[model samples]
Target chain A: MAKYLSKLSKSTRSNLYTVTAILAAYIIFTVLIATGNMSNLLQGLLIQIFYYAILAISLNLTVGILGELSLGHAGFMCIGAFTSAFFSKCTVDIITITWIRFTIALIIGAISAAIFGAFIGFVVLRLRGDYLAIVTLAFGEIIKNVINVLYIGIDQSGFKFSVKDSVSLNLGEGGQAIMNGPQGIFGTPNDTNLTICVFLLILFYIIISNLVNSRSGRAIMAIRDNRIAAESIGINITKFKLLAFTISAAMAGVAGTLFSHNITILDSKKFGYNQSIMILVFVVLGGIGNIRGSIIAAAILTLLPEYLRFLENYRMLIYAVVLIIIMIINWNPTCIAWRKKYSIRNLLSAINKKKEA
Target chain B: MSFISYLIKGISLGSVYAIIALGYTMVYGIAKMLNFAHGDVIMVGGYILFTVMTSLGQSPILAVLASIVFCTLLGITIERIAYKPLRKASSLAVLITAIGVSYLLQNLALIIYGTETKFVTSVIPIPTIKLAGGNLAIPGQTLVTIPVCIVIMVSLTVFIRKSKTGRGMIAVSEDKGAAVLMGVNINKTIAITFAIGSALAAVASVLMFSSYPSLTPTSGAMPGIKAFVAAVFGGIGSIPGAMIGGILLGIIEILGRAYISSQLADAIVFLILILVLLIKPAGILGRKMNEKV
Candidate 1:
């Protein structure tokens, strides 16, 4: 294994390690699940963990790779969730096959989110750093608020949309109010399962990892490091940024599709500022720009609160404290120096030196 | 007549936002970091006031003072513990720490307060002013809030213009390295900015809860965000800009609620922010920042 790793390029080697670790975890969890060793709570959380991991990785493309701070990722996810859920609700009877229906919903979700991403990206080009972060936050809140008041229904004539109350939708005979504004959509199909989630997660991971290693990825990184320098060097900052942002938004939408399908009901309130911040926490804590780190961090942090259910009231409090401590340990200069000095590599090398002596 | 009353009510609400925006502007001007936890400080102030007036049976004035002092101390402590160590770190790290602190404060409040909505008795003793044969009646809270906002803004402007420490803050904001070379105590100046900003937040809490009455752990969040929008609208680093921005935002919000759907009022406010940023990124009063290699 060591010899083979040495033969491969550095990026390929890292990719191998990440993929292998994920597969290993997947195999172990599947075995445990098959043997009925996994608890009910853990089993229920599996799909949620997978979606959150996907969200984190997608967010990493913007925050870590693109070198921007976005506080509205959940907004994109919310868009994806609502649009796809709407599609599924409308086509429930027309689409006989569940898998085909779900596949279309996923596509719809991704495409809708990507469109929003492109629009937001257009506005995003005018701002930088903290300003960009704030605008994105504003946009996210707007999306949520707008969704809250939206009323949608379908009649024999066609689909009806109204920002007013459900009565304003004015349906004909056999017409149903699919989305009842604030009450949200009901009866979304529970098509999400652990196997499908894990499959999608691996697929997204490969897509993102490959994108990161491509030439477009380098241009995005260049813009992130130094916008002026990148522009001066003939990189099309606008094109690359919009591309990355749209892709990231699309992935977030996919995560949203998975989320909405996994549950029986969907509410726009779930895609609030708090949810966005929670995903950001996953991205930040997982080590910014590190894809593998994002996955592991999202998994651990998502599971931490669930497992800490024993802590009761202290669960969130403990979570907050852990968040702070982890940030300090990860980013503090002195801590970084200390970590460098006492890393496992140094320890192993010291042991070998001692043996030689 | 109702329109006139709505205008007054809008001004009053805007005054509260102006106060909160002042805090945001000051901290941003000097520290150059968004103190996301600033909103929670307002909530903390509200809780302190509630405890003092209701539980401790204190006078309203004393309660207000106690809240201000506690919030000031809280702000300073937060800067020292959570933010100071990360001063040399990336903006991303500082931002994350601020967010963590915000969550910590919110969760701590949740643990202590148990998510119950606390109704705060009005501390302002001013009587409601009735006019135009009872067609217009402005609440006592509005009477107190608008004047208080004007007074704070004036004093804040004067202090920044005349005081030595205030000059230090301006110096630091202009260029940190240059300010340090000029013998300004960078840490002390930053701490003072936080103290002053958090103090204004406490005042905003008193005025806000007096009018709104209901207090919750998340009460400060929406107003905090709107005030931030106000700060940005007026041009972030300018004091006068915050006041103007706050009042305009308040009027817009009120008018939007009255004429447009109340549900979409927030959306309108945020939409305005996006438009303002696109058209005038530096804001109404903000100076254009030049990039240097």
Candidate 2:
């Protein structure tokens, strides 16, 4: 009985939920691919599943765990996408080794996004609550517009930069244009696959869940749970906030690299206020502090729009209805009381007892 | 001359923005929530007005009244259904609920209005006012938007000053518990605040879409955000401050387009927000409050 109890408790550990969910998802995906059950549409959506999952997890760190709201995640993602897209585009011919270049792209993307994150975090992390949301949102918008008007090119003379028009890059005789203002980077690389995505997803899961259970993560949560109490205990609010924010930003950037490499042509419009808000929605709906909840929420919501495609224009209306209903069910007082009364733990224990009898 | 005309247009645009800002500022003042859906409510107004005017060929006044009524009802309904339950919930919870409401509204508009942009017919027939020997000309829409904004602002200020419900609202914002103990119906006051704010959004939406000559599902989003910035700029809860902030923001945005690269206007507006946040988090006209704990 004690052995059974210990095993039950090990499997039921809450942080391990992400592990369980990912494994289940991976198995389902593999089976679908093996049996050829996944349609092309769903296959395409798999990329979104991986990237959005990455985005939601990273956003959850700041919004759910760090007790801060950041609306600029898409901005970091944008920086990552552009950095890697340009890197890949410029080096596609220069670097003969495809795997090496992809690895370099990931490193460069992560570092670039982290640098931007550190810059933005330093400016905005001093503020508390809603102010952070607003600043991050503004940063996301600024980055989108900046990217639209920027131009980059590479040739024998190395990289050249201009704005407003790509023609102005004025690369040498054999220069190749990497980015055209507004048009974004066209004809980059499409290297994203379920295998890479799953591997990266696992890596992301390990990093985030570990951080959540770490000493630094505890201190960060202390600040969130009670700023004054945490301060009394001698936690440096600024350092931790910056650390969580920059790391979250770096992870989002890695997702961006994955996303950009997946798509043949990258458009700046995809990484905008709407995307940021959508990611935030995923975090919020995922029960804030629940890592597994974020993963599940991102997966479900990413597939929802496509699932409702049969409804066509009305799908969005249905989407809104679903949002309101979910909040009502999850946040309603009566529902909360009912859930507590019929708690999962009690139900599980009852089943165990019945089995023993 | 074109520059001067842009300035005038900017002011008119700012006037419309002011009316919208009034909605956000008042709601924040009383409800103590950012009311993220206030912008989406403006879209609702535009769609309603667009449908009524285009479908029924109703008189402009009728269209306007319909919009106002629809938004008022919407504001109340949103408060009762989504927000009332979460009144005691955490700030993040309330914020999420507010966003859900926003998504609900935008998606609803998308369903009903379709993905296409609907051209909004002008309600006001005033001719373009030419000045500077015809080098500068202001559209007739400006005439209606600016004057209407002034009239609304003045009336709102007066109503808040003398009216009983207005006083009740003031008391509630000042201190919710005290207001309730003093015989103010907290729910009613909150409802009325929402009604008035949403009514104001109706006017702003009509002006916004009509000026741009088109109404899309996302017609109100940018303007809505800009107006919120205006509300914040003016010291979120201050009526007069919202006015100043809206007008200044409109001018800066327009001039930014005229002089600086048009693409960077949003960046500039956001930069100003950050600078203001860094320098004065409470905003220019906002009274600073010490943190309680």
Write model 1 residue lDDT over B204-256, tens digit each, in one string.
Answer: 99999998889888888889888988998899989999999999899889988
Stretches off by above 4 angstroms in model 2 are A1-17, A342-357
Q: Assess each model's interface with DockQ, reporting 2 decimals per model.
A: 0.74, 0.60
Best lDDT among the predictions, by candidate number: 1
Report the lDDT tens digits of candidate 2 across residue range A231-313.
88899988998999999999899899998998877879999888888888888888897777787788899999999999987
Model 1 chain B worst lDDT run, 10 consecutive residues: B284-293
Deviation (Å) of A6 in candidate 2: 3.8
The RMSD of every model to the true structure, in order and in angstroms, is 1.5, 2.8
What TM-score does the A-chain of candidate 2 achieve? 0.91
TM-score attained by model 2:
0.94
